[model samples]
Target: MIEAQGLTKRYGRKAAVSGLDFRVEPGRVTGFLGPNGAGKSTTMRMILGLDLPTSGTVTVNGRRYQGTVWPLHQIGALLDARAVHPGRSAYNHLHSLAAANGIPRSRVEAVLDQVGLTPVARKRAGGFSLGMAQRLGIAGALLGDPGILLFDEPVNGLDPDGILWIRTLMRSLAAEGRTVLVSSHLMSEMALTADHLLVIGQGRLLADTPLNELIARDAANRVEVRAVDHHRLADDLRTLGGDITLKPDGTLLVTGLDSASVGELAAARGHVLHQLRDVTSSLEDAYFRLTENSVVYRTPVPA
Candidate 1:
């Protein structure tokens, strides 16, 4: 497990992270989400001891990560996939990291096979594609079989199949009772892969809860209805003072009302209903609603 209490960081006059107090427990995939410049990367660096916190503390398994005798064995991270030396072969890269950390050569081969890099083990990293480099980085992280894992944008350069493979691997790791923290901008992928969420904005904790709970709380549940008397139904729905948009496919998307309410309104109007279903919000929708104000930089759409 990973724990942080009053964690903070500052660069000159600007605060990068402030009082980020949260605990990431084992046996779960916790997604770290934030808008651009919201300090997600900085917070991860602090957890791995790459950046020292100006105040408070962060610990892995109740101890400082850097203070551990074998830091790699206690915590493994894939913050940057391309940080490897380009001159080294994939095998040589893993071998060097393992050697420096007292890991055996057999483990290096095992990790190579695990990440599907066995075929390119002897190939120079500089010639590898982005997807291949990502796999190699993951192999290095798994070299020590650490209980705590941190991955930053693991699917950045992956194809569809590769993305699916990564999702399964992360879920399996969490199933093994390990603490997994993933930082990604892919909201849809996170919705499927993560069980919990840690959302930050401007270096402050905005939310720390289960994925479903956040969706339920922030995302409005709308009801979709279709009937022969669409016009009358739309009029009745509009009386509820909710935003209604008619789809090109002839379906009415009604918000600010639940399924039960929509059904009752239809019944009250004595209109025949062909379809009345609740449409829950997607992860992207909830994320936008929660972080709408937290966005640091905004880009205007072209007319």
Candidate 2:
């Protein structure tokens, strides 16, 4: 398990992360989410001991990452897929990491094959495509078979097949009781992959909860209704404090009201209901609601 207590980091006059306290327990995938410039990269760097925190602490297991001997055997990370040497072959790169971490040379071949890079193991990393490079980087992370893994945008530049492969891989790893922390911007994928989430904005911990809870908390309660007398039903709902929106297809989108209440109201008003059901919000919807104010860079909507 990974834990942080009052973790903070600053750069000159700017604070990157402030008083972050959370635990990434084993046996599940924890998604690290935040908007751009929200200090996600900075926090991850501090967790890996790549940067010193201005105050407090973050530890892998019970110890600091920098103080651990044979660090790869305890925690493996893929923060940057392009951090490899351009001139070295994929096989050589893994071999070098294995040698330094006291991992067996045989393990290098195993991970290379595991990542499906055995066919192009001899190719220079500089020439590998983005997807291939991501695979190679994953191979290095698995070289030690650590119990804890951190993947930052592992699906970036991957094809659909590669994306599915990593998703399955992370889930299986968690099934084996290993700790997995994934950071990505793809909410659709995160909805399917993560069991829990750690959301931050402006370097402050905004949410640390289960996936379902986060969705339920931020997603607005909305109900979709289709009826013969859409106009009458909408007007009636509005009078009862329901926020209503009339769609182009003549459907009534009702908010601040539940499906049963809307149905009962329509029935009492003698309106013929065609369809009445709750509109489920996607992860994207909840994420937008949660991070609306946290967004640093906004694209102005066209008038």
Candidate 3:
């Protein structure tokens, strides 16, 4: 497990991360989410001991990252795929990392095959495409067979096939009881992959909860209704204690009351109902609602 207590980082006058406290448990995939400049990368760096925190502490398993003698066997990470030596072959790169940690040479071939890079294992990493490079990085991370893994934008430059491959890999890793924490901008993919979510804004912890529960909170008490005259129904719904939003496509989104109550009220008013049903909120909808005040940048729509 990865644990952080009062984790904070400051750069000159800016606070990159402030008092972050969370735990990433084993046997599940946890997604780290934040807008640009929300200190996600800084937090990851602190967790990996790549950057020193101004205060607080972070630990993997039971020890600090820098205190471990064999970090490769403890936790695997892919913070930057481009950090690998460009002149070396994919096989050589993993071999070199394994050698540095006293890992046997045979482990290199196993990880290379695991990542499906064995076919091009001799190719120089400089010439590998972004997708291939991501695979190579993942191979290196798996070289040590660590129980914990961290990936930052692992699908940044991948095609659909590569993205699916990554999703499958993460799920498989979690199924094997490894702790997995990943950060990405793709909400749809995160919705499909992550069982838990850690959300941050302006370097502060905004939310830490299960993905389904977060989305369910907002979806509650919502009912979708369609009427012959949506505008008239909107007025009637308000009088019936229902908060209403008239969608552009002529659907009335109602809240503050259950579907049965809404239907009964509409029927009592002698109004013709075309449709009335509960509305389920998607992850994107819930994320926007939760982080509405946390966005640091906004672009005006083109006229």
Candidate 4:
């Protein structure tokens, strides 16, 4: 497990991260989400010991990452997919990492095959496409077969199939009781892959909650209803303190009331209900609502 208490980072009086307190537990995939410049990458860098925190502490399995004797065996990470030497072959790149960490040569071949890079294992990494480089980076991360893994934008530049493969791999790693933390801007994929979330805004912890809880808490409660007497039903609902919006398609988008309450009211009023269902919000909707104020770069919407 990874834990941070009052973790902070600053640069020339500019705070990158502040008082970040959260835990990434084993047996689950935790998504790290934030708007642009929200310090997600900084926090991940601190966890991997790449950058020193100005205050507080972050530890892996109760020990700082820098203190681990065999760091690769304790935790593996893919911060940049293209960090490998341009002159080295994919196999050679992973081979060097295994050598440094005292991992067996056979493990290099195993991970290469695991990441589906066996066919191009001997090809120069510099010549590989972004997708291929991503695969190689993943192979290196799994070289030590560590119990903890951190991936940053693992699906960037990947094809649909590659994206699905990595999604499945992350889930499988978590299922094996490994501590997995992933950072990505893909909300749809995160909704499908992550069991929990760590959301940050302005370098501060905005939320550390289960995936479902975040969606339910930040998303507006809405319901959809259709009935034979739509106008009358809408009027009645408004009288009962419901905020209603009549759609061009004749359905009523409702808030301030739930489906059950709407149904009971319709029944009591003798309105023949055709449809009544809760309108559940997507992860993207909830994410926007939660991070609206945290967005640092805002694009002007067309008026």
For TM-score, the strongest prediction is 3
Query: Which residue pairs collide in model 4, if any?
Result: none
Model 4, range 1-303, lDDT digits (tens) per residue? 999999999998999999999999999999999999999999999999999999999999898998577789988899999999999999999988988889999999999999999999999999999999999999988989999999999999899999999999999999999999999999999999999999999999989999999888754457899999899999999999999999998999998888888988998999998889988888898888789999998899999
Q: Give the clashing pairs for model 2.
A: none
Top lDDT prediction, candidate number: 4
Each candidate: what lDDT? Answer: 0.91, 0.92, 0.91, 0.93
| C-alpha positional error of residue 46 in candidate 4 after TM-score superposition, expressed in Å | 0.6
Model 4 lDDT at residue 212: 96
lDDT value for model 1: 0.91
Name model 1 segments beyond 4 Å from true: 219-221, 224-256, 262-276
Error of 2 at 198 (Å): 1.6
For candidate 3, report its TM-score: 0.93
Model 1 lDDT per residue over 1-303, tens place: 999999999999899899999999999999999999999999999998889999999998888786577777988899999999999999999999999889999999999999898999999999999999999999988999999899999998999999999999999999999999999999999999999999999999999999999988754557788988888889889997766889887789988888888888888889898898977777898889789999998898899
lDDT of 4 at 11: 97
TM-scores for all predictions? 0.87, 0.91, 0.93, 0.88
- Pitting candidate 2 against candidate 3, the one with the higher lDDT is 2
The worst-scoring run of ten residues by lDDT in candidate 4 lies at 214-223
